[model samples]
Target: MSNEPVSVGDKAPDFSLQASRGRTVSSAELSGRPYLLYFYPKADTPGCTTQACGIQEALPALGRLNLTVIGVSPDPVSKIDKFADKYGLEFPLASDPEHELADRYGTWVEKSMYGRTYFGMERSSFLIGADGHIKAIWRKVKPADHVALVEKAAAEL
Candidate 1:
């Protein structure tokens, strides 16, 4: 990986992963279009569900801005399928079980909880512009406020 960390002005890293419901997406295909790439820790968890549903609720408005949203997590395809079905999420939920994409975006980091330290995806969001450059970045995002922020950013895109 390059030494650069993803930031507002840097080019977004490339990725190709399997999305839920047998759909797949690649950064190559998303090129020339603005999109939101969100990295979460796991599937079917409280925070993850809230974030996904929040995005779900904002889909219509985001569409008006011509922005696409794809969620990434270190979960398997089956788990992502269950998550999407349970929550009725219409957006693509990409599987990143190996943390390949997370590493590229620098979202994977050391986390500590209750004195237990571990490495995991650090709930982050990236807004990639139509020119393939990152327009904005939100690291360690709060789920409750994520969607509205995304909506606002998209509208201005």
Candidate 2:
């Protein structure tokens, strides 16, 4: 993948991934409408949990704005299922264990923590418009600030 992340106005990459509750989500099916693809580092961890739960709480508002939300992670489907079940998250949590989607989106990135460096998913979100072009992009996002930012962007979209 290029060092540059997918930017606003770029066409979103296609994906078909397994999700919680034995569901499948694909870019094809989500076409002709706006959607939010939020990538997190892992499932069920502190920040991830906070972000997921916050988004879960705001689902009604987001749906009212006609924005579909999908949380993507490098976790397996089984782990995603568990995370969703544990938190009662109604939205799809897609598994990206192979990072195909992340690579295309540029969220799978090099990171560092605790004096160590590694590659991982950056906390990011992309708002894709009905025409399939990206409308907004948020990278290295804070979990607490995600929903409000997305809400504002989706409303404007």
Candidate 3:
């Protein structure tokens, strides 16, 4: 499967979705701050949790750089809420149940687990500038040190 990826210097695609914060977050509302938009497979899973909590732990430093962290997954709002609460994750975790945002950003993909191949959301992240342009793109990310990388990118912004 191939997708036309959003790249550095490209204008970020607009989106409006339900976030665990109980708000409909839109690209327009995120215009004034550098934002990190990360897409993961599911809530409360190992790698996804690791990636999310990493961002959570680094939120303070990221915020100091005026960066807003947001996570998107196909899970329903209920699951997203539970995961956020369980982890004390303060960032907005948006629900992309239809994966419109993921498809637009090229995070939707095909994967295999024990020979079961299916379409799914790839673990990815996009750093969007205050001007709404893609600043960086990370694909096939490692959850462990992911947050630190985002923090470093925020520092450069």
Best by TM-score: 2
lDDT of each: 0.91, 0.94, 0.90
Point out the worst 10-residue segment of candidate 2 by lDDT: 1-10
User: lDDT for model 1, on a 0 to 1 scale?
Assistant: 0.91
Which residue pairs show collisions in model 3? Answer: none
Q: What TM value does model 3 have?
A: 0.96
The estimated TM-scores of all candidates read 0.96, 0.97, 0.96
Instruction: List runs of model 3 lying over 4 Å from the truth.
Output: none
Better of 1 and 2 by lDDT: 2
What's the lDDT for residue 15 in model 1? 88
Tens-digit lDDT track for model 3 on 1-157? 2378888999999989999968778898988778989999999999999998988888888879989888999999999999999999988999999888999998988899998999899999999999899998889899997887888887998
Candidate 1 minimal-lDDT segment of 10 residues: 1-10
Q: What is the Å distance of residue 87 in model 3 from its true position?
A: 1.0
In model 1, where do residues sit more than 4 Å from their true spots?
1-4
Model 2, span 1-157: residue lDDT tens: 5646788889999999999999999999999999999999999999999999999999999999999999999999999999999999999999999888999998888898999999999999999999999999999999999999999999998
